[model samples]
Target chain A: TQLLEQSPQFLSIQEGENLTVYCNSSSVFSSLQWYRQEPGEGPVLLVTVVTGGEVKKLKRLTFQFGDARKDSSLHITAAQPGDTGLYLCAGGRTNDYKLSFGAGTTVTVRA
Target chain B: GAGVSQSPRYKVAKRGQDVALRCDPISGHVSLFWYQQALGQGPEFLTYFQNEAQLDKSGLPSDRFFAERPEGSVSTLKIQRTQQEDSAVYLCASSLDLGQGVDEQFFGPGTRLTVL
Candidate 1:
């Protein structure tokens, strides 16, 4: 079973639309990270949330960590075509070198 | 390279053939990791190395898989007797060290292996 679960396996929206993606798990994580991957490239780190109830924003993208650290959400406002790609959430634990990843959400922003 | 670099961005091997994928992590990075990713799925942990020591390898799928980093820099993942099911993208990542709270892992473009 995938330790981390991302909802809305595939998302397609207009260029100006807003969208949200979720990552859930039963196990608590010390830190959770959001990454965006483009075709033929590696995933790039977008943000990291280490504290429960933390909310972080980068431009139009907002990331929130749940109070229990077992869930996370990414919201994009006024999405652009550049936002189209696979969005992955990875959970990490203290002292553990391995990251548990979710089966990612593929977001396609139509131009 | 400023970031992690992987060799042979794409590889095609016949069934029962052996293949080797190489990864060169960022300079001075102490942690190196290997992961396998199937289409439409997240990358799964395969193995990990700290410096030149392999601290964890519990995720290796089978005995045919082997990895090594002899000099604490470059790493190689070798698979023997490849099967069609072994086709996937192999990714390599590197981090400065085990993070106290947050560690950022920089990933390579990944090697796409196709077993026929």
Candidate 2:
């Protein structure tokens, strides 16, 4: 089974601070997706990076996929209290519908 | 149109008891998936359905776990003789199509199951 490992399982920062979360894996993937989940709710898709070295931005959040397709990253700028939640990265393999997800990073932005 | 929705936001069952979880996907969604998520962990794939056909179920932990989507709209996951280790949150997701490229999956609130 392919495993995606995320760095900094927990993060706490001030509202104005910036943070970056990393997701790494040895296995290659066809596409990678980023999601943020709040308490009592399922994960909500933030972005999907399909091509190697692809990058996408949503508001203050930026998502990037590695050139090897084995890793990905999510960067949040000027974090706010509303950004406090669990962030997850998932990857989909070629010709497969299943997705392998990283453990997750819990971010807490203090106001 | 409504997003994916799951029934019974939470369930508590005794060991060896039988439990059923239900999922209602978005209208006209052609692909549906079920995943199990332990506390403080990411969701793990459980099964996949394309319309009424169950395409893959390799992620099911054991034979006691069974999932079915009869009409391709609503799906049910039943666990027989449930064990304590089977406790986790069950999430249902749906995508418009799974043809190629990236198919964004929309998820439901999920049903949290606890076995005593």
Give me the candidate number with maximum DockQ. 1
lDDT of 1 by residue, A1-111 (tens): 579999999999999999999999999999999999888788899999999999999999999999999999999999999999999999999988888999999999999
- In candidate 2 the C-alpha lDDT for residue A41 amounts to 91
Predicted candidate 2 versus true structure: per-residue lDDT over B63-107, tens digit per residue: 999999999889999999999999999999999997232688899
lDDT (tens digit, per residue) of candidate 2 on A1-111: 439999899999999999999999998899999999998899999999989999998999999999999999999999999999999999987678888889899999999
Q: What lDDT tens digits, residue by residue, belong to model 1 across residues B1-116?
A: 69999999999999999999999999999999999999999999999999999988999999999999999999999999999989999999999986333689999999999998
What TM-score does candidate 1 reach? 0.98
Give the 10-residue window scoring lowest on summed lDDT in candidate 1 chain B: B94-103
DockQ, all models: 0.68, 0.65
Top candidate by lDDT: 1
What lDDT score is found at residue A73 in candidate 2? 93
List native contact recovery per candidate, as a fraction of 1.
Answer: 0.62, 0.57
lDDT of each: 0.94, 0.93
